[model samples]
Target: MTIKPIIIIPDPLLRQVSKPVERVDSDLTHLIDDMLDTMYDAPGIGLAAVQVAVPRRLLVIDVSKEGEDKQPLVFINPEIIRSSEDRSVYEEGCLSIPDYYAEVERPATVTVKHLDRLGKEQLTEADGLLATCLQHEIDHLNGVLFIDHISRLKREMVIKKFSKAAKSKVTV
Candidate 1:
């Protein structure tokens, strides 16, 4: 397992919609491992495949607080089958977006369907932080970022800031 460098904003790939995984195999599993490792190393609760430069409808999440058993989840070709009308807000951050974070309002509950790590079908209903995390990562599969939920001016400013930061890092 290895932590791959996250693809940051202004990278066009993050905006491109990810293709669904057609088959689960050793390769896909390895990607899952890498994603898990990356997310943990990121010290993040969730990560999307696009953040790692893999344009696949894949994501890894583990929201268990420290000291709890690590609960890793892999979602392959996941789609939200249901979502509650009630909304909740969370201050969300992305590894791809580095330190920037913003409050994003999303469904308070969601039912998602996907294939698990062992190639088994799994469906889960999540609420609260789990619900927000699920929706945030799912947005990545659709080429949308949490920042997109913010105002247009805010989004543009964030993108420009990140783009400039990226350039500075490149030249340094």
Candidate 2:
């Protein structure tokens, strides 16, 4: 599987809402494989298709700790069906945002409905890091970023920083 280039902040594509996956074919399967490869290569727990400039409602995640067996998960057209009122905070990072991280509060548990790798419908009840990762990636599908959960001042500062870096790369 190929490791795709991850699009960073200030890239308009990263803000684009992803389209739902209509079917699971060989091409879709290949994309899933590539996404998993890309996520692992990024050394990140989760990744969304939009982060790779693919406007598809797909995401890959592996929240396993180092040295443990990798447990990769694929979610297509994922939607949060239910979420606990209980809240939790995690220092969240995104591949698209690179090194930036922020404490984001979200539901402690979530029930997500999505299509499995085989296109079969599945509902996953997730908690802890898994729940946070799922929520983060699913937010990407809707053109939302983890920074959006932070204060507006901090979010703007991050966007400005990345925007300047992106400009330098273009001029260089």
Candidate 3:
């Protein structure tokens, strides 16, 4: 597996809704592997295919702490099937939006259905950081961002800041 380049903020691709995977074929399996590699290299708990400019309903997450046995999970065409009414706020960050984080309120628990890496169907209930991570990555599949959960003023400010930073880097 190879680490792929992650798409950053202000990329229109990030705003595009990802298409569902038609089949769990070899290419899709390779994509899942590459996504895992990219997420681990990014040192992030979760990643979505859109972050890699693939625009497919694919995601990988590993919430294990350092030195612990890693438990990587791949979600293909995953969807939130249920969520608790209780809300919780977590300071959320995205791999595409580097060095930026803000508190975002969402359901505290969620039940999701998806295809595992081995092409097997799976369902799981998640809470805490896992729930936050799942919602954040699922937003990517729907062309949404955690920043979108924040106030409009803050969201635009972040977009502009990233935009300026991107411009400066390109100019250099």
- Candidate 1 per-residue lDDT, tens place, 1-172, comes to 8889988889999898999898999999999999999899988999999999999999999999999999998889889999999999999998888899999899899999998888789999999999999999999999999999999999999999988988888853
Q: What TM-score fits each model?
A: 0.96, 0.98, 0.96
Cα RMSDs, all models: 1.3, 0.9, 1.2
| lDDT for each residue of candidate 2 in 116-148, tens digit (9 for 90 to 100) | 999999999999999999999999999999999
* lDDT (10s digit) by residue, model 3, range 83-132: 99999999999999999999999999999999998878999899998998
Please give the clash total of every predicted structure, in order: 0, 0, 0
Worst lDDT 10-window in candidate 2: 163-172
Runs in model 2 deviating more than 4 A are none
Residue 30 lDDT (model 2): 97
Deviation in Å, model 1, residue 32 alpha carbon: 0.7
lDDT of 1 at 10: 90
Model 1 CA deviation exceeding 4 Å by range? none
Q: Cα miss at 23, model 1 (Å)? A: 1.0
Among the numbered candidates, top TM-score falls to 2
